[model samples]
Target: MSQLLRRGVLVACLALSSLLLPLLPVSTVAAQSGPAVTTDKDVYDFGEPITVSWSDAPGNPKDWVGLYPTFAGPPGGSSGATLWDYLDQGDGQTVTPEGTLTWSQQRPGQRDTWPLAPGEYTIYLLVDDGYEVVASTTIRVTGDTDGPEPPPEDEWPANPSDPALSRKLRAMTFNIWVGGTQVKFGSIVRAVRKARAQVVGVQEPGDNLERLANRLGWKHTFTSDDGYTNLISAYPLSAPKRSDEYAWLRFPGGGRVAVSSVHLTPYPYGPYDLRDGASTDYVLFNEGTHLEEMKSRLEALSALAEAEVPVVLMGDFNVPSHLDWTSATAAARQADGEDFVRPFPWPLSMSLAEAGFRDSFRTAHPDPVQQPGYTWTPGYPPPIGDQPANLTDDEVFDRIDLIYVHGPVRTMSSRVVGESYRNAHIRVRPWGSDHRAVVSNLRVRPLYRR
Candidate 1:
């Protein structure tokens, strides 16, 4: 028999074979070669195009692949495939054994765009246009693809003409990786001095907060028991609270601002999990665990939010802001070849915003596409202690370190401080820490005492 004839016979038997597959032992199927289908990526941002590749097809012109939502059940002719195409053009009777099909705004023979919603989907390689699956695989499409909020407009003035109207409070948030012991401690001191930050929130400050304060002749410093979060200010700090270290900043100019420094748990991070095809609920649950732990701190901040005083919360949040990870920005990044980010409402950052705090960097530079302001690491993979060496390939650089403000404070300007000129507004030579620094200039309204 000719190869085509044998393939035709095999194609005819495929439907019968599929009916018996459930009754046969699993090993029987494992031993046989069959038509196979796969996607280029297991996960994709919503609205991003999808590509389905198949091999070992029966080569019948009628053999086709159908895209279906994972829960849509077995491919039935009446069920209707979300998108499909014949192995060969509809007119041809011969098909190659292997080929690829892409679905974007439209596919062959389809005029309307059928964009897959955010969820799991299945690709089926069926026999002779019949609903007998020869091989199949799953892929995830995720993102908030609807009603993208307009990018925020820059609200700060081009240049403050009045000294009184100019921003007076300069705050910096830095995760000095392992207390700046990663490099010369002096490098950390110089970074703060050069930024000219009046107050600084320091994360992972193990005994280094005081050392830094001493070097700068700063009188006040607060450190947590776990050595995870700390604060060092040029003025004095009062009413130091625990569980994320909330303190009262007493500026010499007679202004008091509420400050908190926090370093939330980093494991089971949402971006990594989401990229690995985890469900949105699972990602939100992971971040919710952190928020549950910081409930007291959040409540206190909420009360502060209701009060008349200016409040500043800063540190390594270990999570991305919902403002930065919008549907619009996800599409923007995918256009530039970074495809993992999606519109995820990270609970911690969203909760803070709900409590009236604003991301200072984002407040100054509202267009996420234009100013990503990534502060998580100047060096990808970092090559640092205890971090997995494979991080270079898996990690997404993000702006986790932040200085958030609320009440009578307006962000004049915010910029990143890092190891290089390209990523940082203020470059510090031989940057001491893995995470970059965030500095924001704020115009503060004086406290009104009754």
Candidate 2:
């Protein structure tokens, strides 16, 4: 009995030792093998230098680190680096596995003075001069100074008004889907008020135009016979003799302008067809019909365009702008699912441009790469239709709703008003509509008849 007891004790001790093996010191095991990066501080005072440390990196000469403002788009070279430094300090020599580098606005090797501004920024350890980030960390710089800090790098200068242009106007194009029946109407009212838009061109009013205008206390409202398009304004709007597409808007100071609200056919949307790998010829063929529809609406206003009468056309065009579909936008597949639909000369916008109309949002923001203002469905109430089963709930995002300006109107400041600041240039909570709204601060010059 004693011999059996001793044998059992030995067996239990061996089992216990095996169970405790993993709990031993980490030094007894191999270190984790992969690139790792961290900043000495997560937050810093304005103008303070930043120190980033890294370890277990590939150590290639091209392996580098970049500091980018969070609003500067993705980490790739598309936005360009605010500050960058290679592990070898651009000496074309390999570097050690781990080290530290500091940047205080002026990049190490460059002579130009690129001061690190106060804002949220990210640090990335990338390899081979590419966007393949081995590791990354985020840091914020607080504006601790007494005076106010400047706007972010992406912010457009506030209404760079041309000296000759003085009559100020704020206009908006909103498509309150199905009269915003899905959400509370007060939210829509709040959205318009938040935009501070004096003149609004509305689509899908759906018997709610009067209610909306009454709620906002706007004096004038125009609704198409078919209820497809509508207009509401603080200024007086004279109904044209026999037109549903446009109305004469008279400002308090005697400036006269024409405003049009149009909702183009949503059937056979060009962006989705393009995404389905449809040929350019097919897409343009469909757009040709859209072009005809647009021609019919603007035909009566042709002389107005020629006469340099300021006309603001706002609507859900149901198509992306030609200016947005460029080579720079093509380089980045937005959010991974969207296809590269660039260099596409969308005929509708091209026709509008030929008629001397400029996209108000694009006029305010010239760089498509810097700001791809996607005002289409804001990734809510996912697309539902006879779509392919393989298609995800949220697929494509493009700027389909638009505000176009003709004649003497100058788009001063333009921004997208949507559910959140992440999705729009301005945030109007309880966004109410699936499609975001485009609002522009415009300066309209008075038209003097010859």
Candidate 3:
């Protein structure tokens, strides 16, 4: 009788234990049947946004998923001070009700959007109420890395390029990608001629500024051996004073206007050059550091603006103006789509503004909410030309190519010039460059008492 009773109790206990197993933590119950988590790409550009996908993830309060710095440590997330990029003390993230991590799950950390520097890192989905990681994958962070408001009823000028104004100077800034090799060169020449601007500046002008100026019947001055940037004037330009980074030109007839065509550090160094080091500043909050680290550069340009002649500085400034980074534009872009990047004031512009240079485009188009006036990329999807697709779907179409003026300058109009498929600007045949030209008509006086 005693033996039979003991056997019955053992059987009952076994049955109860099997029933209780289903109620334990999810990590103990589910076996990872597929890829636990993975990024779409193995190697990412310096600031590239990643798409991390996973087959299953639980939305429980005791679980979480995050990307952590692995350094030269273990990939299993087992043996290091795994610094999670997020400050999430919450239960779950990047997990769906249907048990999947979507493209949108590749979100940046809240504290530092640019979390990863150029190095190796790992992603982990954890379950010890936040201590033990159940699944993990690795990713690489290769590189480093606007507007406005308004409650006003905007009144746009019909003839924004007001011709009636005297002392008006028209200036055009062109990156002329690869010295205008990307597009038919003749088209660029024709476009410049058609604009009839007194001042023209080109970035990456290559070793052909003199010939190109001759072809356009414009006087040019860029004595530097680097030949990366050139300053041309319909009015004769006194030989440029050269620097390792820029060229200074003088237009005595055009009210003693001093001009400089500068090509600042292009990527991994320029202001706001995060994530692809080109058109991707909006999403990252850390872009200001690049500009902050380059204060000496800002002062040098400021000194030029304060020089004897009123300055009309132009080039692929490689930095956007502060006008595009107001609280108003941020609110507007919040609903633009999942891919839209959040923009910061890109500190270089702030530096220039503080130094007294006026952004001709912003001066003319005061309402950034109304006139974004993007000068990079033809438009989203690049509707025409041999235009290439953007590095990312969320790539920012910014106005980095700029023309800034100082010393009592008034902007009458500023318009972007290029292929007019979507922008409706005057159409140029066989688009001549990757960057559309920034042409601004301004009324100004010479501060130089020559």
RMSD of each: 16.7, 21.3, 13.9
User: What is the lDDT of every predicted structure here?
Assistant: 0.73, 0.74, 0.59
Deviating ranges (above 4 Å) for candidate 3: 1-166, 225-228, 239-255, 269-297, 338-340, 379-392, 447-450
Candidate 3, residue 42: Cα displacement in angstroms equals 17
Q: For candidate 2, write residues 226-288 as lDDT tens digits.
A: 665589999888777777778888888677888888888674566765664555654565565
Q: For model 3, how does the per-residue alpha-carbon lDDT over 342-435 read when each residue is reduced to its tens digit? A: 4454556766765677788877777877887777766323334555633445455667888877655568888878777365255676667767
Candidate 3 lDDT at 8 equals: 100
Worst 10 residues of 2 by lDDT: 153-162
Assess candidate 2 and give its TM-score to the true structure. 0.60
Total backbone collisions for each predicted model: 0, 0, 9
- For model 1, residues 1-450, the per-residue Cα lDDT tens digits are 999999999998998898998998665345767779988999988667888888999877788887765654667622356567777745437776798778886552332324555677788898886888889999988775343332332321122121223338889998888868777788889999999998898888876778899999998987655554478898888764443547777766676788888887665456655655556655564465567756777787767656766778887887888878877889987787666667767767777776777788887788888898988766632433454322345457788998887777778899999877778899887778878899999887656452
lDDT value, residue 98 of candidate 3? 23
- Tell me the deviation in Å of residue 335 in model 2: 8.4
Question: Residue 5 of model 3: what lDDT?
Answer: 100
